[model samples]
Target: MKLKLVLVEPEGMINFGFILRLSKNFEVDELAVVRPKFQVDHEEVLRFAAQGKDYIEKVKVYESYEEALEGTKVCTSAKVSGTDTVRDFVLPWELKEYVGEPEVLSLVFGRESVGLTREELSKCDLLLHIPASKNYPVLNLSHAVAITLYEVWKQYRLERGNLPQKPSEKDLEVFMRVAGELAERFVGDEVKRERILIGVKRLISKASKSELRSLLYLLSRCSSFLKG
Candidate 1:
């Protein structure tokens, strides 16, 4: 299992720096930032990033949530309450069942204040919430990243039971491109396109590599059949 830490519209530079270190601490391979307000090369952020700056520099900046998650399964972390889709918050241990298959995982963390919006949450196949005290159930961004990444790595080790090379970025891109094409074909209504895309993205994110490949093959066959 490969994991990337995505921070969406983070406000503070210090938090960014700390999270960068946390990514290194947890051995996260990729880091992506979506529409950040602060400068990536800011002194405060750089100072803290320090040795982790190498990873920080490699951080991909995305204009939108969808673009950032183009080639990976994105799991968004959100608050656990209200009329939200978040019914039962899955513990870190339960995360094992969600992962295990060979796939790239993008663990998305939203803003420091408000977590992922309902619209953003819709894109995520699964919602991961740190089980906090009911009294006060909010966590800092860096802390959340640390906890989530740690749990994911732990579960990955247990399930994989063997070390293997992760899928290349090019492979992930090809898969996502195929998925996008399939969505465009099957889901044509402009009014409902957004909704269908979200659902489809969620479904694909959870699929194993083999399953995704199978879906791509099926999609290709369907396209060929139409052309024929």
Candidate 2:
């Protein structure tokens, strides 16, 4: 699985440099920063980056979070644990299962102090939370990125380019598009409508190829019926 590490509105120069290093170490396809607070070329950023300092010039800076994550399935990180739609999330270890069919994955992370907001977290296609003790679950920004990348590497590297057959990307995109239309057609509440779309997208990500065929066919037929 190809990974892109995305940090939103980050403020720490140290975390910035460490993340650059992590991106290099983990082979992340891209390192994207949204509205960063520090100068990317600052001396402190270079100092902390160590061997990773070469990547300083390679960072992709964005003006907004939406612009940063344009064309990838967004798997967001959070620190909380709950059943609420906004906070409900998959564990980092289980992320390999969600990488299905899609080649590029954007792993979006929030700021150092407060993490992703409820609205931002809720809009994610797949939410991931690294489990920790009840007393203090929040991890430092770089550490959290480290753990998540390590887990992704641990699982995906074992595949050795021998992943199981799944629906083609074109087919998956059509399935998601139709499913989204159906959700918009039937679900009245805009927020609930989005949750339905997110839930369906997550299910599609986790489904086996055979299972996806059936689910896709069902959703397509439903959409056709509504269109008629």
Candidate 3:
């Protein structure tokens, strides 16, 4: 999984510097800033970033969030509170369940004072919140980034340790096709068939390559029997 850290409209140079250091610590593939209030090469930024100054220099600056997320396959926005319309909240620890090994995954942090706006949060594919005290629910910009990155790094390490070989995109595509065909054969109703196919896709998405291979073999045998 390629991890990209994005800070939207960041105002504090010191915080930006700390975030750059955090990005380096977590081995983030790229660091992006959208419409930053301070200059990328500000003296304080370089001073705080210290050894991570190199990362700050290479930070990608964008005019808009859309441009910042150009190549990102999965995007998650950090928010203090959930919106009524966008209520699919995934805690920082549970991020692995929502996120697979995508080629590029973008984790977006909003401004300092107020987190992501409703409109900005709406653009993100998932919403992630850290569990904190209700009295002081909000966290400092760099601190929030640090926590989120740590959880992501933990998940990456777990995946590397347990599952050496994960399923590729092609493997997932083939499984989805076969699963859809099987669902169609079993269900005559169009709506029911679509729902079943979608459920099957989600199930296969969480499987490892070896597990998916076993499932495909079983499905093939069952398909033959049904045809016979």
How does each model score on TM-score?
Answer: 0.64, 0.66, 0.65
lDDT of 2 by residue, 1-228 (tens): 567788989999998889889888887888888889988879999899999999876788999787777445455554555757666678888776865646778888998877788777766788888877768877889998999888877876645345555777776788888887877777889999898888878778877677788888888887778778
The lDDT of each candidate is: 0.74, 0.79, 0.79
Q: Model 3 clash tally? A: 0
- Pairs in clash, predicted candidate 2: none
Write down the worst ten-residue block by lDDT for model 1: 158-167
Residue-level lDDT of model 3, residues 1-228, one tens digit each, is 678888889999999989888888878888989999989889999899878888865589999788887433333444443446574577877777876766788888888977777778778777887777877777898898888889988887545655456789998887787777788887899999988888888887888889999998888888878889
Candidate 2 CA-lDDT value: 0.79
For model 3, state the Cα shift of residue 143 in Å: 0.3
Instruction: Write down the lDDT that model 1 would get.
Output: 0.74
Candidate 2, residue 51: how far the Cα is off, in Å? 0.6
lDDT of 1 by residue, 1-228 (tens): 567778889998998998888777778877889999999878899799878866676688889788877434555555665465643356666776865554777788899988788777777767777877878878888887887877776776534534433444565567667666766777788668777766766666666666777777887787778768
What residue pairs are clashing in model 3?
none
TM-score of 3: 0.65
All predictions: root-mean-square deviation over Cα?
19.2, 17.7, 13.0
Clashes in candidate 1: how many? 0
Candidate 1 runs further than 4 Å off: 70-74, 82-88, 157-228
What is the full ranking by TM-score, best candidate first?
2, 3, 1
